[model samples]
Target: MDITSLGGERAAPFEPTFASAAESYLKHGGEERYLAPIVAYFGDRPLKTIYPFDIKAMAEALYPSQSNATRNRQAVTPARAVLMHGYDRGWCNFIRVRRFKEEKPKRRKPATAVWLHAFSRQCDKDGLEHLAAIVLFMASTGARISEAIALRWDEVDLTARTALLLKTKTSTNSMRYLTDEVARRLRGLKEGNSSTDRVFRYSNRHSVNERIRAVCDRADIPYKPPHTCGRHTFASTAIELGMDVKTTMIAGDWRSSSVFLETYVTPRGTPGRVVADRMNVHDFGDI
Candidate 1:
């Protein structure tokens, strides 16, 4: 007992539950969709008692056949976030939960300029000028579908050839310059619309995708979703056309170079030919 007093007053019991930590996390504005399943599985369990194996078991139980990426996103991420919250408060010791192994991601094929031209013509033919403008804006500026949907007429400056993105996935405001072609489209779309109105009248991504799918069918072009056709296309096209990585990242508002390179950039056309031509200094008669 005397030794306990000398050992620096015994640490108070760490008894915070996962549920309590989750509640706090949500109160502070953590996304509910990611934390919902996590809270349900680890409800009322003391943070100190939870282990990596328990997290793995929870992921398997919740999403048995789901991919490792899904497991890491839906299970491991939220659980770790909650535990870290608790640890920050000194309610429990930090626990490291290993994420499930993910397979190498496949490179995405972006929509070619030819495909975009075809799609645009079909949209005009189908009386879908608004839809065409939306796609074009995304393809030119690398704006996400959600950002395109939320764009307002006031945010656009046709004379300046710039548009303001008020809310982005990164939770920051960004300013994107409009391409000459995009500015022309916006000018046509703005003629009948009020300054306060949204540039594209669509309310949600689903409706926009549906309209895009129909146009893709009519255009007879391979159907890439809005994301693949728009943001992905912009990054790939910019890089292929000799835009430097840093400049492209700034234009597209990409905060992370790694993410921009890995997720958005994909090889297009015959780069090997360009490389060979550049290295043609060495000549061999016959090998």
Candidate 2:
């Protein structure tokens, strides 16, 4: 297809391809500047080829070079390194490439635990029980903070002790199995909330975080909310507790295929140590 043969107006309308969308998102500004680059990671190629990370593609765009004799399976070492950095900061998601002809990178990390305990305590102390609903929901349901905030009260089924999850961390809008705590918390919110009517209505991801930070300072906990560390706390704890991977992923909230487990490097709970003088080993272990 020659350029002259085509009815070329100025250029093609910018279809918001993931990459294009990410660029547009960055330009629009706000929370997306942090989010945009992270969203620009996933590419159109087989995911493994894009693995470990797309450092080569990132360093020198994703171009099919006949002259460039590089193995198709080469690992993007630098990009992987960048991904590690991003993961540490809690931006583990696919980042669509904005540059034309370049493949985007994919992110596969989960939140950590140290930050989550801090956030939960912050909620407990701040009188932000409204915010506490969110902290607890994320911790118990393993739902993303976005999903928890966007949740409609009616979506919660107290009788069933499950909250309906949609349009969340995985970007999939499907029914997710939220836990019993989600129900209890929602009920508490319903009893007292009288504002715009969305549970945690004043919440956006950033504001909730900023508020959490303030709460942390007051509580004497170092205030650092790493992107989705709360969610990481939930999933990692779920995994350690022997929760079935499928059941744990009730809402696709946590991608079953991600390296999230590796990054979930937190002890879920205290291991029991038996004292022979006080108790039998059978008490510590299921006899």
Candidate 3:
């Protein structure tokens, strides 16, 4: 019998080392951002040598310098991917990595009218029309920053007052109604750009967020996360305008009204105090 055919199973011709497998995955998988850190963690270790303790140590090491969320997302997720790649290629056994639990803090107050006015005025003063338009679009539509950035001219229908939004979590959200101001701002941005062009020229979410932060600093507003204000502002404003919760949920592309209520809605200045004000005085004779 030939040596190669000794066993019933034929092994892979070439088994990659741990580092090489990771490099291959990062190159072909197209997540180059994690390359440096993955290489630093794994070094020249062979595919079969890594253990769960090593993964735990790496997670613990990352916690001192990075948030638990970032540690798990950036380091742990990619590290697991590298291991999985090696396992799939028959170079190593399966190693399951545990991810960290990341619980975010709740917001005490949503973005208010005062912040919006101040931020918009600052954007106008800075002549950041693109940033201004983005702010306006988010404020009016309750759109996620990702959704707004990915919007194309072809998706906007000014005449019909509708927009075919792409990349929403649910495929059911392709069509959304647009406010006149939202439509107008979109038209303004589209004046010189082609239908195929993105509505905003923002190269990345970070750049847009940086601009918002700068405006917040200049306007003396407390900095919330980039789109926090816009998302909450749209919901709160709609509620204040007497829009029903169901309608507001649809407008915000929220899957559930409970999340919309918990995250976005808050008691206004005197809505609660005045609840019985009209009830007792306006119809006193009937009651």
Best model number under TM-score: 1
For model 2, the stretches where C-alpha displacement exceeds 4 angstroms are 1-125, 174-182, 192-196, 224-229, 250-252, 265-287
TM-score between model 2 and native = 0.50
Residue 256, model 3, lDDT: 78
**Which pairs clash inside model 3?**
none
Which model scores highest in lDDT? 1
User: What C-alpha lDDT do the candidate models reach, one value each?
Assistant: 0.89, 0.54, 0.77
Model 3: runs farther than 4 Å from truth? 1-104, 171-173, 278-286
lDDT of 2 at 40: 51
Candidate 1 residues 1-287, lDDT tens each?
A: 76586876676865789999898878887768778877888899988888889989999999999999999999988888888888888888888899999998776589998999999999989899999999999999999999999999999988899999997998899999898888988888898888889999988999999988989898888888899999999999999889999999998999999999999998865879878886787777654
**True-vs-predicted CA distance for residue 94, candidate 2, Å:** 24
The RMSD of every model to the true structure, in order and in angstroms, is 4.5, 12.9, 6.0
Rank order (by TM-score, best first):
1, 3, 2
- Models 1 onward score TM values of 0.87, 0.50, 0.63
